[model samples]
Target: MKILLNKFLPKWMVLIIDQLIMSWSFALSFFVVRQFEFAEILRGHFLIYIGLFCIVSLITFYSMRVHTGLIRYSSIHDIYRIFSAVLICSVAYAAFVALWLAPVHNIDSVNIYLVLLLNFFIASTLLIMVRLGAKALFLYIRSGTAGSKERVLIYGADGYSILLKQALEASNSGYFSIIGFLDDDPHKIDKDIHQKRVYHVNDIENLQRKFNIDKLFVFNEDLKSEFRKKSIEKCVELGIKVLTVPPTEQWMSGNLSMKQIKNLKIEDLLQRPPIVIENKQVASDLAGKRVLITGGAGSIGSEIVRQVLSYNPELVVICDQAESPLHELQLEIKELFPDANVAVCICDVTNFNRMYSLFKDFTPEVVYHAAAYKHVPMMESNPCEAILTNVLGTKNLADLSLTFDVEKFVMISTDKAVNPTNIMGTSKRIAEIYIQSLNNISGKKINGNNPAGVAEPQTKFITTRFGNVLGSNGSVIPRFRSQIEKGGPVTVTHPEITRYFMTIPEAVQLVLEAGTMGKGGEIFIFDMGEPVKIVDLATKMIKLAGLVPNVDINVVFTGLRPGEKLYEELLNEKELTIPTHHSKIKISKVRNYDYEDVVNDIEELLKLNKNKEELRVVKKMKQIVPEYISNNSRFEQLDMHMN
Candidate 1:
């Protein structure tokens, strides 16, 4: 019966019902004026009077479309429509009686003006009350009456909070009930919104105790990072789930739904303030210039590509050996920036002839060399591949950049290169040394007396070194997420192991700023904020997934993998950093390397076949980087023998 009524009610029936109520209100007003004498209503042309009132009321209601709204979902706007219809009917009836009807019919039973006013008030009130009652009943029925609903406290007392509450009440999900609001604004504290008290954020514990708040909904787009982090931490500690709604603009058709709200993740808490860059300098360096980016499909390199495109580069050559990822990147670029001048090159950097052809063809003004094998354990086992890519590939790019007279070459290095204990880190350090030495020699040749057959050097090599990037491929965060999805033990290398972390975009922004700020031969080190312990990170991730750490999901400490370290360093013991204009960036000072000798040693190291004599390659690497020490691996024996 309820379904039939909800589905089959027509607009004309609503119009007829409103007219009948207004007629009844008119009759009741006469009865009240006549001192409860029901007979007095029938004394003087009462039937004609009621007929006139209905005619005027129907005209006004129809014109206003007051019957168009569904009663069960009526809003304040529907009330306004009802009021307008009543007021218009009252005015028309008063004018008809005073100017025309009284003289034509000689009817003087009661004051028509007072009767019309009374009808207006009674009719408008009844109409609004019916709609409100229906709306409330519908909400109650949709929200269900059986199970205990989870009480939710909204974190902001604003428009979004009100809308979220309305959405929750209207949804038939029967999962959540909004208790009240919590705001940081002092003036808003203790105030009432929608009959719910707004309390300060500090009152969360009291509210939780009183209302048993099972969740907190944060909808404030302008929330500060520190306060957000603190609130999330407090919520986690109290075992209350924290959720967030999408931004106001993202709401669908000015309506929010329960599906739009999502549980807050560990990433939200770990995010730092946005990095500010010297845009003018970066634009000046990149604008209208041809730029080449190796590993353009990978995380750091792809971010560099996206950021560089914003600077309006004349052409961007995306060079990566991976075909599928490069194709995906190309498709994304086409969708995002169809007019962007971009070309994809699927050639390995180590392919000297192909790279030479590319350089000769395009003659890039700047090159961002971000291609490297970064997985520690994988690179530990495949030392030869790591050296081939990180060392020889870098050398190939550097030599070609100089030969092609590229204006600037920005090489992406890592914190692992500092005080290296792993083959990957050592190879990167070797790349860094060779590039710095090449830059020094190029500068000397440019400044010195011109020798026969010697060309003026143009390429300036700059290296930007930072730590792990969040959300990068094969990073710990993704691994933890996968493990959590599988509902099993999350593996950590060591309980005490720690590493600095930064967002990929932030790291790339600093890289661009450092690249633009460099003159030549400078290694730029970024200030990666506090290092995070891997075990704590895993525990937090598990908890954020609504699972109890070590109970629902276990974090097992596997012994550190080969080439792994308990702590990572941004600078070697022998190198110190000098301040730069940007506080987050610094310039590293290290002993200069002899360019010819470093090049000859790298050539010798590359010539040794890993298939036949891998130890000889390791020994040669140790010879190049005197600080290279192997720990907890088979290569440690080589170190012992050398000692």
Candidate 2:
């Protein structure tokens, strides 16, 4: 009968169904209030009052949009809205009955008072319960066989767990049986959660073996590593998955799913306390300013452009040499903010005269130099080219910023610079040194000018150094996504390789904020969360695509490339990085190179450009960055012989 009603009845006709529900609710209220005994004349006269009650509640519910909401999604928010509307309707009914309906029906004063109060309570309760009944069915399916019901266990069985269980049970998405709960608190031992006794977490093995449980659901609001580690180890041993649903915000962001058992990430198992962002300074730094981004078409650069725009920069200059990308960046800028003055420039930072010309012409207030030969293998093949671009290009930009008097110069650097294992890292380390030295000398020159009464602009130079951005062009994420889409082999350099990662936007925002915190010469090392195993990354990518790893998609390990590290480092043995106002930002304390010494070294490196002595160039980089180590390179011979 319900199926037929739903099939033939238009949605507008559902209002009639709602009216019937209201009438039924009113009748049930009287039965509960009057102990199921009919007072004939009283019942006949009260029908008018009951009818009025149903009409008012129906109208109120509709107006409040409570009726229009999907009955199957009656979350606490939905219930709150329903109850609010019901309360308003009940109060109006009470007022109307007391003022007008009572005299018309000639209901005795005492009886009318009793009826109104009792009827309001019963009717309001029934209305909510009926919608909840629909919502409850949805929760049931979401938890159990109706969805992806791999037998699972819930830990803690706390209020959140109860909410989780209800949502799972009523969700038409699946069926979640009352798999008994587990709690460490002994006082709650043998306690029934909907008649299911609370079991010890140690009993997971027994349940996994018995029910063939496919997953373990951890429901602790906060995760303790010892407990989380034990749970994961047990699940791994049993070939069962351990999943966490996390906070409500994670659920709303689509990061956590109802099917995704609300709980913790692997990070939670090994999490340190979160770093606090210095909000006031971050907002004030770029709240209203003109910012220019070099390589703005590239990953980190483009992201910088996006983030700075969010802080409402007066203007953002996106400069890149690549034709296709710059065009796309312009379009993206147009689509995102049609009114934003995002100018596209087709100039390379390596061209000193051109860069200086642009700085002078555009009068850019700040510049973020992100352009460089980033790919390690490619840079290894073209050593001289990498040196020119990474080292000399940085020189051009910094010198130009100093000349044109730009507000700040932010050079985006990499974690590979920490204990350099590749030419790319070595080159970046060289660039950092060159940029830092220039900033120091520039400060001296500016200070010297003060005594001569010569005016100079404050060009604060800052370098934001971090490891890797996840989905930037040519990043691992895009490569893995493409490979998985092609229906096969996901490539990894080595089975043991790992690197630190942060979302592009998150990294970019920190980069911009770090740039503004510079006090002349400082390399702000970003606090990258933690390094993730490449193999595990590949596996997750495969599974997220709903494909089995070995059976469906192959993950092939193809030996490490030239200059690549099995694991990237963020700090050096002899280095010290002091914290800023933000725990996530650190300032490296390093020895300063003399201006004459720096100038001489740069000249020596440039002379080697024609010498075909690749080792000499790498050695020169070592002189600049003492921590530089040439991993798997012929340049190691140069250092050995020099010693």
Candidate 3:
């Protein structure tokens, strides 16, 4: 590009030099037109104006932030600015010539205006032509230069792979010549994308050796874990760079600019599964309705609030105990949608009286109860606080949402609820039962007004069950990043332990979609794609960061936490599920309790949690989620381990 600009600058200088050639030619034409020597001398003054005009225009172009740098790929707006600047400067010179020379040199206004008009028309045409021509030549030279173009390969022979290829060829985004695709699928072998063949994965080396390939762009959506390490190793052996593009970002739009492309990010290295968004109807019930998001500063709560805002809700109340995150959320909401009527509230969900008042004042049509003590280790140590926040806090909100006539309530749950062996999961299971039993008991009691020309409110309760969010607070990804930055062993509990993962947007979107799908007493389970082993995850991260695993950094095996599992199950041994809109998400079938009986038991448990034995609450949790079984946890030895 720099060389092309250098070539373009000399051509422009030659055009300036043509002013002298044109001057001598015009003098010869004048001698022919008037057949006199005096007329020939008039071309001298004309030659001076032509030379001065070109010099002044070139100087003004540089001052206007044009011409000095490469303008081959400049936008139309840039060209317009250049033309405007040159035209203004040329017109000013024409005015000065007519004002002074009209009386002294006897030059006419008509001739001066004609020269000004023609100069602008010709200068704009020539300037634009030079810019466009330079860009074409730059691309030609860039593509044609020996050993300059990078030979790049892509993994996955799918729709995204094709889009990635087209985007690279059609735009100045990635500076790579896409050779073809690499896939393990036998059916895709020898197939073509944009006339480029989809070769077998085994053939990547032959191509790398043949063409001297530089990089491999893997589609993160279709990456298989077992082969990921092998694929990365192959690239490293061949001294080739490996890059990845997120499936969602496969369709690049307005953000594609040369300058922007240079500032690339590494999100594609994250190996989370493809997000399957099925429940689109979840947000329908929330449209134009007042909504409240407790723990709004948190990962799940913040996402819920953001998704709710998109539905054009009547009002959104963001409540959280944390002050710093609340202030940040306030600024974000204000900047995103200035017209939105959003309230930033600093009410802790554990403070029953305060939370109850806040819920009553706003009277949210839908309440997303997300606040809880979720960190496994933290909740394990402070069992009482977890009970107070997750168990009692849920009870308070669920009761208020019922009493204040809220339309619907959605609770965010985890797979840990399936046979919970820790305080956090146990506390959540208690809350889940309270929501389920209440829906069974309170049917249509929240009707807005009287039956005769009055509003009728039917409170509906829905619970969204899913696994870990990728980059949430206290997530393992951030922990690994921190550990890796410290340049040492990155800890993994067990080489065989694995867990399901999803991006924040994907999880929250599914929650919104599922929320609107429920018809009271339904537990929505999101299909978190394949589970990635913790050991393999650390290995991939090390490779992505350009470090050799087990050599440069070690993977330490730390014993699992208090109630941690080697493998997490989405459902219990007896639990069954049926499909909904998308195959990945489902509705779990579980036993429902009579509203009054369960509610009475929960109220007794809440009081007992304060004065009675802790086993009383643990036993109630076991009863609610019948699948719940005590695993390798202190909670199982309640009385024996109390001391």
Give the per-residue lDDT of model 3 (tens digit) for 536-582. 77876676566777899899998888778777767766668979966
Q: Could you tell me every candidate's TM-score relative to the true structure? A: 0.85, 0.71, 0.71
Q: Which candidate is the best by TM-score?
A: 1
Question: What lDDT does the true structure give each of the candidates?
Answer: 0.85, 0.72, 0.71
Candidate 3 residue spans exceeding 4 A from truth: 1-66, 69-202, 208-214, 217-240, 244-283, 444-457, 612-627, 636-643
lDDT of 2: 0.72
- Model 3 residue 165 distance off true place after TM-score fit, in angstroms: 11
Indicate the TM-score of model 2.
0.71
What global local distance difference test value does model 3 have? 0.71
Report the C-alpha lDDT of model 1 over 1-643, residue by residue, as the tens digit: 2353246248999999899889999988866666676667667677888888899989988998998877876777788888888998898888889777889887763477778878888888888987788777776664564356788888778887887777666555545777788888999999999988898888888887888778888763633467867876787767688887887778845446677878877667666878888999999999999999999999999999999999999999999999999999999999888889998999998888888888888889999999999988888888898888999899889887876778999999999998888989999999999999999866445332232223765789999999999999999999999999999699998989998999888899999999999988999999899999999889888877878889999989889899888999998888888999999999999999888888789888998833536788889999899888987667998888888
Best by lDDT: 1
Residue range 1-643, candidate 2, lDDT tens digits? 2232133234455455666766676676666656677876464666676778777877777787765656665566766875687668767777887788767766655555566566566656766787777656544444344334546666676776775665555443334565777676778777888766787777777877787775566654545446655665555556556567666555553223566663333334434333445556766777767777888889888877877777777778788999998898888888998888777889888787777667766777778889988998889888998988888888778777776677788899998888887889888888887777777766445322232232465677787788877677788878888898999799998989998887676677677668767877888888777678988878766655556787799999998887789999777767798988777889988778676678679879977865867767777777767766666666667667656
- Candidate 1 clashes between residue pairs 3 or more apart in a chain or in different chains: none
Task: Flag clash pairs in model 3.
Answer: 279-513, 282-516, 447-457, 448-457, 449-455
